[model samples]
Target: MPTSVKIFDTTLRDGTQGEGISLSVEDKIKIARKLDELGVHYIEGGWPGSNSKDIEFFERTRTMTFKNAKITAFGSTRRKDSKACDDINLNRLVDSGVQVATIFGKSWDFHVTTAIQTTLEENLNMIYDSVQFLKSKGLEVIYDAEHFFDGYKNNAEYALQTISKAQDAGADWIVLCDTNGGSLPGEIAQIVGAVKAHVSTPVGIHAHNDCELAVANSLAAVQAGAGQVQGTINGYGERCGNANLSSVIPNLQLKLGYSVLSDEQLKSLTSVSRYISEIANMHMPINQPFVGNAAFAHKGGIHVSAILKDASTYEHIKPELVGNKQRVLVSELAGQSNVLVKAQELNLDFDRDPQKSKEIIEKIKEMEHQGYQFEGADATLELILREAFEGLEEIFTLESFKMLVEKTANHAVVSEAIVKVKVHGETIYTAAEGNGPVNALDNALRKALIQYYPDIKNIHLSDYKVRVLDEKDATAGKVRVLMETTDFSSTWNTLGVSSNIIEASWYALVDSLRYALLGRTRIEREDKDQLEQLGVVNH
Candidate 1:
């Protein structure tokens, strides 16, 4: 039988410490529920006493039930020379009323001396007292010895003593933490091996990604007999980041055959990763391992040709296993097979026509020459296909648009824009003022279109990004704008490119709204198809 490895996820705690990641109480609860569903052995929520939001999380989460996961409350150990039971902060950890307690203690001499202003001996006493006290209260104690790797490197005896003290105090799991995130894989393995030999309790490892070696170090520790892997989902943390359990969990189970998540839970990995990213309002990293946009995305004729023959030639694991599907990107470098796969993915019935495939491939190549990158603009490509197959209904058209901006004496740059659009055999004109020319133009167009399509009231631009096509300075310089919008149901992103900023912005903005409505239309169409199949459409 393979060893059973416990996966401890800290996305709600450590991951929230990542730059620009601040979750509300509601956000934390949602993420915690997802993590529980993901089959993580332990969910390390934030320090409850430190913030009201976290306090609310514990208060609310305690009432819920998790069939497989335990909610662990995280905090630092007792203060120096303070009895754990007497320490107010430690009492707060107990009062949080969780089944598990994960407390961090000083392990490195430098942190003990400088950060905590305590002596080395006092730090050991703090670890011992905290774990013993928690155990006395019948809580499962997980002692995370902060900076353990560096502490072991500098003062081996001191680090070993800290681990020993936690074990002696009846800690259920003695977790070695690389708080500084500077240790290499070899050192991690060696220190973890030494710690395992020195202690009888289950040993665990927590690593950060300062040197971009958190994942490697975590695997090394597991090989060295550590039973638990501590990391945040998506590798989110302060400074660089912590180990990513998304990669760690799958690698451990698939490569080493160490049991972590169940096969069913593992299949939800991609959805879980994206769900958290969406709630946190962060763009998911396109190259994130196992479950990213580019994880299974293939391009280039040679690679696509081989992938078509057998995915295992380039893929390490089946894409479906991680809740992700293989994607064939259409670019200038792509071949006929790439387009065919893409068309298939879109469920377009091209009838396996070689001539039609060649034509689409040529059209993509021509679009690429015009600074229209299809890889980043799949919605646009879908629109192009819809127009080609079913034809498009142009209910509205932009006749002309212009803007003027000037600096006033008391005010900053003043801007006004006028838009003339023809809709439903009528020409409507609108003028709007804004902080900038782009804003003015957007407001004017949106104001005019709301009357024609009342659903446009649900449409609002959520995000906008502009990128320069080339570094050259001249009339040849082209710009691309990506726009994201949300309707009542879902969000969609589209892109446009032009030498004129207004033109590019308008193209992206118009498509963004249309894409949202189009998605709803498709969902309705699918529902109708199901109804027809069941003979319920007439009803």
Candidate 2:
């Protein structure tokens, strides 16, 4: 068995400090459940005494049950001139009902003198008293020496004294935080090694990413004998964010051969990362390491050919180990192998017909030249494959559509759309109103089709983005629209190009619906075929 490093996730506490990340108590609980599912050792719930929302979050977790992660409450050391026993913050930590308590105290003499406006002796007293008081309440105290790295560099003796005080006061784990996030990896390793020499208690690392070295510094600290790693999922925090646990966990487990999470738990890393991003209403960084969408995607022609032969040619490790799959991107720069690999992944049989594969590659190059980008729109690519190779049948044919926009006397604009389509030779006409022309068109189209395909209700547009292909043409320039739709189970993107924005949006929207309905029809046909082969008669 490899040595185990405790995975301490501070997504709820530090991660919430990220801009545009605001979680309701419910959102925090949902995320906490996911973290527990991921087998994190400790989850810093939030700063209990700092806000009512955090207080309510802890209150809600008391009724919940977690199988793996221990809930920890975070706060600062006792305030100036306040006794630890009487401090409101310390008392709130005890009342938070968490088994673990993590509190930060000033380690830098500058912070002690200027930030806290306290003497060095009083700062040490605060650290000692707070840890002892929390321990007296039967809580596991984890002391966070804020700015320990910078403080160690400035005044090594005083920096070591803060952690020593907590150690003597029964701190379970003394964590050295690079609060300013400016320390390099080399400095972190040397400082952490020095701290281990001074304290008998286990040491941990809490690093930020201002210098883009949080993950590097964290790994460096671990190499220096730190047993616990602190980070936020997707690196969500203030400034440049904290070290990303999505990257850190896999590195510690697979790359370094340290046991941080179980194999099953490790596989949930990608889902956990996306889940947090969804809850935060933030776009997951496409290039984020280990868990990003493009992490294992091959694009270069030579790279794709090599990857098709052996993924090890370009990939560092099997993406499936972390619940991510390898992707072969098809584009103008892609080779014939890229087309074949993508076709195979989509269940298209292009192996026996080399001409069809060549046709797809040429068609993609021609389309890309006309402002059609298929790289981000897999559903659109699948549609093209089915049409070219499998001979996809149309679910519905559009007859005509009209839109009307009217502004009231008060300047409130209202848009309405009428759509006409033929489903199995039956004409369906519907009308709807919406806040905008595109929305109205979406509503009218759905109303016309929902009667024939009830599953259409499950499909909703999640995102819509538009880009002008030629900026020099200005108003007359061609525009490209990318639309993302989800059917509750999976999400897909489609692309459209036209001179008119509404026309572009309409093309993408129709493709989205057609792709979804076509998939359902195919599955139904397959089921019917299977049943017929099994001699089951339908009444």
Candidate 3:
């Protein structure tokens, strides 16, 4: 029988600590419920008394039941010289009605002497009394020895003594934290092994990603006998970040045979990861482990061919295991199998046209050489592939456009934009005013396009970003514009770059609209085909 590991997720707590990630009470509750459904062993809600949102979460979460997971309230230990029962923070934790309590105490001498302005012994007392107090109140207490790894390296004996204090005081679990995230995997395993031998309580590991080794260190600690792993869902935390439970859970259970979530539900990992990213309004890390966009994507010809024959040749785990679909990308370096797989994904039926496939792939690679990364934006890439094979309609074209900006008497900037377009021998000229020149131009373009494509009304610009390619001289650098757009159902991103900001924006705007229209068309066709197959429609 495989040993079971507890997956303690702290996304709502630690993830929100990420700068600019301030989730409301409703958001936290929503995420907590989803995590419980996903079978996390524990969900670390935020410190109730520290913030209003967290306080609201505690109050609201009391009424909800997480079927599989224990809801944990996270906070620091009671202040030095304060009785645990009387400490307002401790009372808040109890009143919160959380079944579990995680209290952090300074383990590093530097933090004790400098940050907290307290003696090392007083910190130990704080950790011990807090754990004992919470445990006595019938809550499972987890002692977080903040900066434990660094403290252990600095003063090995003191760090051990602090953990011993928590264990002796009734902490159910002792979490060793790499707060600075500077420890390597080998060092982590060795230290965790040592800590396990010394501490009586079950050891858990909490790591940060400063060195980009939080996940690796957490796993190493588990291999070294830690039964619990604490992390954020998408590795969200302050500074570099905490360990990513999404990666940790899969690696521990699938790669190491330690039971975490249900084996069947492991396939939902990708969708879950993307869902959290969407909720947080953060860009999903394409290269994230196990469930990332590129986790199972094949690009090179040799790799694609081998993957088609035997996936295990290069892949460590099956793509479907993490709910991630395998992507055989078509580029100049792609083989026949790459083209076939790409075509199949797009529902394009082809009968072994190696020459045609090669030509299309070569064209894609040539375009990619001109600063287009199709793999990064699959929707745009899919459009390009379809256009190469089926030829896209021009429908409408940009003829000439001019924008004028004027500062009003009230110092508010007014933008006026005019556009002229010829659509199938019909000339349409439109003028619009907007808050800014870009908005004006955007309005003008939309005004012109909606005449033929009324569905364009459903398209909305979600986000726009501009980056300078070269910063050697601020005045002379190429600029890149990235635009994110949403239609009825899905979202897509497009990129364009030029020396001129307007030109770059225009390219990205047009491509973003094209991607949306193309996706809508594909979805409609797919629905029609499904209806036909179900005998609801006939050709």
The candidate scoring highest on TM-score is 2
- TM agreement with the true structure for every prediction: 0.90, 0.97, 0.87
Query: Predictions ranked by lDDT, top down?
Result: 2, 1, 3
lDDT-better candidate, 1 vs 2: 2
Residue range with the least summed lDDT across 10 consecutive positions in model 2: 1-10
After superposition, the stretches of candidate 2 with alpha carbons farther than 4 Å from their true spots are none
Instruction: Report, for all candidates in order, the number of backbone clashes.
Output: 0, 0, 0
Q: Compared with the true structure, what per-residue lDDT tens digits does model 3 show for residues 77-124?
A: 989888888899888888899999998988888888999898988988
On TM-score, the stronger of 2 and 3 is: 2
In model 1, the runs with Cα more than 4 Å from the true position are 113-119, 351-353, 404-407, 411-417, 424-436, 439-453, 474-476, 513-539
Report how far residue 282 has shifted in candidate 2, in Å: 1.3
Off by over 4 Å in 3: 106-124, 154-157, 330-337, 349-355, 397-400, 405-413, 422-425, 436-438, 465-481, 495-504, 518-539
Of 2 and 3, the candidate ranking higher by lDDT = 2
Residue pairs in collision within model 2: none
Estimate every model's Cα lDDT from 0 to 1.
Answer: 0.86, 0.93, 0.84
Per-model RMSD to reference: 3.1, 1.5, 3.6
